[model samples]
Target: MDGRKPTLKSSQKVSLLSSSVRTVIRLRRTTQVLKKGLPSRDSPSKVLQRQQSLGKVKAGNQASFQGSQYFTFDTSAQPPQSIKKKKKRPKNPRVLYPGCSRKYLPTEHKSKAKRCLLLLVGIICFQILNAIENLDDNVMKYELDGLEKTMRREVFGQALAVENVMGLLKDYLATHIHNKPLVISFHGPSGVGKSHIGWLLAKHFRSIIGHEMVLHYFTQHHCPEGVPAMSCQLELSKMVTEMVTQAEVEEKIPLFILDEVESMSPDLLDTLGGFFHTNQTNEFLNAIYVLISNFGAKEVTDVLLQNVTMDLLEAQRTTEHLRTILSPVLSQIHPLWTSAEIVPFVLLEKSHVRSCFYEEMMSEGIYPDPNHIERLVSQLGYYTKGELELAITGCKPVVGKVNLL
Candidate 1:
C-alpha cells in the first residue's frame, strides 16, 4: 500500500508478452488465409516488411497506396537541382583573322578609288582647257577683225563678196594645218574688181606676213607676148617652190595669187593645178591659191541682165545659178577649175562706178565733187534694164578718168 500500482511478477510479464506475440501471429495467419483466395507473388514476410517501411516513410512525406503498390514521399529530400540555362555569348568578327588591325569593310579602299577618279577628272579638264587656249592663240595672230573692217570700208558694191571672202579666210586661217591648198577662183568681167581683190589680199598679207610670203603673179605681165609656155612654166614653178618651201620652214601660210589666169597656157595651168592637189608636199598644201579670171564675163553679164529688177535674195539665187552654169563650162576649159571654189563677181552698177570715181579722186589727193563724179560715171557705157544700169567697163577707167580731172 503506499499508493503505488501493483507490480506483476517477471514470470507473469513474460507469459503476457508471449501471449501477445501468439495473438499477432494468429491474426496474420487469418489475413493470409483470407487473401489466399486472390493470387499473390509476395510472401507474407516480405509484404509485412514493406508495410512496415511504408508506415515509417509516409510519416513526413505525402504518399499514396494502391491495392498492390505503395508510394512514399520524403519532405526532407531536396528537389532535383534546377539545371541553370547557360546564356550564349555574341560572336566577335575579329576572330576570323588574327593580327589584322584593319576593318573587314571596303570603306578605305572605296575612298582611295574615289580619290583616283577625282584626280583623273581634274587631269581631263586641264587638257581640254589647254587645247582651247592653244586654239585661241592660233586665231588671235591674224587680227582678222581689222582686215574685215578695212575691206568693208574700201570695197564698195561688193558686200557679199567681202563677207564670203572674210568667212573663207577666217575658216582657213583658224588652224595652221591643212590637208589641201585653198583654191579660190574669181570669175567675172574685166574691171569688176577681180584683180583688185587679189591685189588687196596680196597687199594685206605682205604687210602682215612679209612680202616674200605673198606671190602676186600676173599671167599677162609675167609671161609677156611671144614667150615660150614651157620656159614660163619652169620659171613660175621655180618661183613658187622657193616661196612655199621657205614659208613652210617658217611655219607660215603663204598667199599665191595668179591674176588674168584666162591668158595662162594649158601647161602653166596644169602646173598650178599640181600645186593645189592633196597629194602635193606640205609646203604646197599650206598655201592659199587665188586665181582671177575673166573667162565667164559674158555669161555673168547675160545672167544679171535677164533680171529686170534684182533684190538681195534674188542676187543670192542668181549667184548660185551662175555657179551652176559656169562650173561645167570652166571645168571643160581646164581640169584645174574642177576643184576651184568659184566666186562670181557681178557687173558693177553705175552707182558703184560713181563711188569708184570719187574714191580714185580722193586717193589721188584731189577733193571730190558730186557733179564731177556723176560726169565721170556718165562717161562709162552701161547695159541698162529698167532703172538698173550696170557699167560696161565698170571702174576700169576710173584711174585714167581721175587723172584727166
Candidate 2:
C-alpha cells in the first residue's frame, strides 16, 4: 500500500536463487550436447591441411594473413631455399730468382703487383748503397788521423797552427757538399814552416786522391823577377782556371797551394777571388786553397815576443787577433784579402829552434851528443831574435851548420 517496494521473506529469496542456478545448469548442459554433435572449427585434420597450404605459399605473400597484426606462429624451423657460394681462383706460378727481370714474370701477375715488388727491391738496394757510403766515410776519417799525426811530426814549433788547420779540414770534409771552399792564408816570417806545412798538406792529398789533384805553384818561382804585373796576371789567371777545370772534369777536389803568395801581383790575387765565392758547385766547394805569405810577419813576431816577455798565456796569439793585425796589411797588398782566412805561424822561440836543430841532427843518424847539440843551438840564437828580415842563420841554414859542426 505504501509507495516503497516490500522485501521478500528469507525462504522465498532462497527458492528464487535456486531457480536461477537451475536455469544456468540447464543452459550449460544444452550447450555441451550441441558442441558434441557439431564439427570443431580447428580440428587436427583441418589444421594440418591449413599448414600445408601455408607452406606452399611464397614467404612474400605470408603478410596477407587476416590476424597477422595480433598473432604469429614461428616458421624459422623450415629449411632455407637453395643458395650458391662464390669460389676464388688460385694464383699462377712465376719465377722467384733475384736475377730474373720483370719481363720474365708470369703473364697472370698484375702490372700493379710487379711495380710494388720492384719498388721494394729498389728500396733495399738504396739502403745497401747508403751503408757502403758510411763505410767509405769511416775509411776517410782513419786516413785523416794519419795525416794529422804526420803534420805534427814534420812541422816543428807550430802545433797550434797544425791543430787549427786540421779543424778547418775536418769542417770542410763534414760539409763539403754544401759549404764554401776553405780559403786559408798562412802568414808568417820566412823559414817558419809555412811553406813546409803547405807541402805536407799537398803530399797527404796526393797520397789519398792522386798526384794530379794537388797543384803547387811558388809565386816567386812561377812569376819571374822584373816581369810586368799585367803579363804575370794574365798567365796566372789562365793557369788557375785550367787547373780547376781539369779537377772538375776528373771529379776530384782540387788542392791549390800558392807558396810565397806575398810575391804575386795584386791583379793576380784579385782574379783568384772568384773561385772562393759562396755560390759555387760541389767541385769548388770541396776545393782547398792555401796562400803561404810573409806579410805581417813583423807584427806576429812582435806579439809573440811581447807575450813571452810579459809571461802571458800562449793562447793570447789567437786566430782572430792574427786576422785583425794582418787584415789591414793584406788588404793593402791584395784585393782578395776579405775572402781569405789569415792564420799566423808564430816566430819560433829559442827552444823551438833548438828542437829543430836536434831533429835535423837525428835525421842524419848522428849520435845525440849534448856538446854538438849545444853548439848548434848557440849558432841558431841570432835567428830567434824576432828580426823583421829573414835570418841568414835561421832554421833554413841550421841543417847545413849542424853538418859543419
Best by TM-score: 1
Question: Across residues 154-224, which tens digit of lDDT does each residue of candidate 1 receive?
Answer: 77677777777888888888788899888898888888887788888988889888999999998889998
Query: What TM-score would every model get versus the actual structure?
Result: 0.70, 0.60
lDDT of 2 by residue, 348-394 (tens): 66566677778888888887687777776665544334432223334
Residue 199, candidate 1: alpha-carbon lDDT:
80
Against the true structure, what is every candidate's RMSD? 12.7, 17.8
Determine which window of 10 residues in candidate 1 has minimal summed lDDT: 59-68
In model 1, which regions exceed 4 Å deviation?
A: 1-129, 308-310
- Model 1 Cα shift for residue 165 (angstroms): 1.4
Backbone clashes in model 2, listed as residue pairs? none
